[model samples]
Target: MKYIALFRGINVGGNRKVDMKQLRTLFESLGFSQVSTYINSGNILFESELDTKSVLMKIQNCFHNTFDFEIPTIVKTENEMKKIAKSIPEEWQNDPTQRTDVAYLFPEADSKKIIEELPLKIEFLEIRYIKGAIFWNIKRENVNKSQLAKLISHKLYKSMTIRNVNTARFLAGEKE
Candidate 1:
């Protein structure tokens, strides 16, 4: 099956410095086919017959062994990503004033509970859950003032990996 694996908090701001070339080599070494990485943000596309859980475990272990740090990985089949890319509201897709992002939830995350825990309402933020991910947008102008912006330091942030909507679409093969 074809899959896209999103690795969280790696190769970002000089922190968890994972070289894409070596990462791809590791995937190839694991017997995955057509392993390709996207834009240095740790998004990998590959084909493997193993189930999602197996793939996740293998990749996580490889990363830990190679980097000496635990990097959370989220795997999604091509079909799943396609559906998620299409789930964003059209208005948000075209709105230049908004910054749209999709957060791929960990298998153990309860989407309903997370949604319930969010503030009752935030004028500059809009959030929705589709499949196993959360699609949210923050008004560009109000991002600094938006409560949702505080999630970076929140405990909930640890359970998911996030990507800009455009990047998500690109990973889903819906965009160049």
Candidate 2:
């Protein structure tokens, strides 16, 4: 099956540096096929007969053993990723004025609980839960003032990985 693996907290702020080339080599060595990485932010596409959970665990363990850093990995089938990409609200698509992001929730995460924990409402922010992911939009103009910024320190933040709408779409093969 074709899948996309999203790695969290790598190659950011000069921390947890992981070479994409080496990552591809590792995946290849692990018996995956057609492995490819995008942009250096730990997005990998590959084909494997292994189940999603097994793939996720294998990558995470391999990465930690090789790099000495714990990298959380999320694996989703191509169809799942495509569904996620298409789930974005129509109004958020191609809108330059809005900063849209999709938060991939951990397998153990409770989407309903997370949503309930978030602020009751924020005028400049819109959030939706779909298929174990959180789709959110923040007006660019209000980014600095939006309470969504507080998410960084929120406990739930550690349980999910965020990707920009464009990156998410690209990984989903919605864009060439």
Clash tally, candidates in order = 0, 0
Compared with the true structure, what per-residue lDDT tens digits does model 2 show for residues 2-115? 999988899999999989999999999989999999998889999999999898878877876898768888889999999988989756753768789889988777466677
Give all candidates' CA lDDT scores: 0.84, 0.85
RMSD values, in order shown: 1.8, 1.6
Q: Which runs of model 1 end up more than 4 angstroms from their true locations?
A: 94-96, 119-121
* lDDT (C-alpha) at residue 167 in model 1: 89
Residue-level lDDT tens digits of model 1 in 53-141: 89988887887788878888889999999999888875665367778888899877746678666543466678888777988887788
Give me the overall lDDT of model 2.
0.85
TM-score of each: 0.91, 0.93
Candidate 2, pairs of clashing residues: none
Span of ten consecutive residues with least summed lDDT in model 1: 115-124
